[model samples]
Target: MADKSSSNAYWKANIRMIQLFLVIWFVVSFGFGIILRPMLSGIAVGGTDLGFWFAQQGSILVFLVLIFVYAWRMNRLDKEHGVEE
Candidate 1:
């Protein structure tokens, strides 16, 4: 219910937040899980190598955390933009 410019700004901010979250998710799930596996092979996590752990579990955990974080952030953004219900 704000002005047109305010509405545009809200959408822009929302898109930016989505983009950032996607990038982080990609890095965690792809970068750490696959691309950087070799570099992380030496480290141990929960009885497996760091890379394997990331590929199997860490990425999933990170994704779930990101989901919660995104929801929380979006709520704040909605309030800021006067779009909350």
Candidate 2:
């Protein structure tokens, strides 16, 4: 049987990672793409405002990157917690 404390620690760590990724997703998709759009308007991106690029493409790219980052981090965490598959 797995040690209860170790299992708890692993779960906590997993949750933390998930939270971090969610925050990043929110920031890129909403903060940069919408709320801060006007501020980014002056910046050029593919002949349009930076905000447009973010809303149309940047957020998706960032999300993809975050997915990989989360996976990589979780893999390491799993190994550290002796829960790797």
Candidate 3:
């Protein structure tokens, strides 16, 4: 046997990636959602403030993008590290 314990490592790395992405998602959504909205009040896109869009929609879009990106990256990492199924 050549030893095959890479799966566990890949799983852990994937989990770490997910956690990091989630934390960023939370900060962008909630932190910018309310707590920091005032500071960002001056930044406007069209007629809406940055934070306003973050709260109402931007965060959700970012989260979705993060998810797909995470998935794609994880797949690449796994393939590179010889851990994919």
Candidate 4:
């Protein structure tokens, strides 16, 4: 039915968005903070190396921003799919 297809589409889009955000978070928190720390050591932020900054603070800030961004985006997505509250 049309409703079922629409629901599937909505879920697909939502999952895609979540995957994208998760990749971003992983790259920031794990890649930069650990795996790529040596490469980023030359860069300074808030009196520490970029990697440390990401490990200690930058990733958290990015995650908080992502939370707000995800909420706003989901609201828009819901409205687009006629599922808004």
Judging by lDDT against the true structure, name the best candidate: 4
Model 2: per-residue lDDT, tens digit, 1-85? Answer: 4677887999999999899899999989898899999988899987899889989999999999998999899889989888777
State the lDDT at 18 in candidate 4. Answer: 99
Residue 47 in model 1: lDDT: 81
* CA lDDT, candidate 1, residue 56: 88
Segments of candidate 2 deviating more than 4 angstroms: none
Pairs of residues clashing in candidate 3 = none
Candidate 4 Cα misplacement greater than 4 A, ranges: none
Q: Which ten residues in a row have the lowest lDDT in candidate 2?
A: 1-10
Q: What TM-score should be assigned to candidate 1?
A: 0.88
- Stretches of candidate 3 exceeding 4 Å from the true structure: 1-4
Which residue pairs collide, candidate 2?
none
lDDT per residue for candidate 1 within 1-85, as digits (tens), equals 5577877898999999999999999988799899999898889887878888888888999999999999999899889988888
For each candidate in turn, the TM-score is 0.88, 0.90, 0.76, 0.91
lDDT of each: 0.89, 0.91, 0.84, 0.92
Clash count, one per candidate: 0, 0, 0, 0
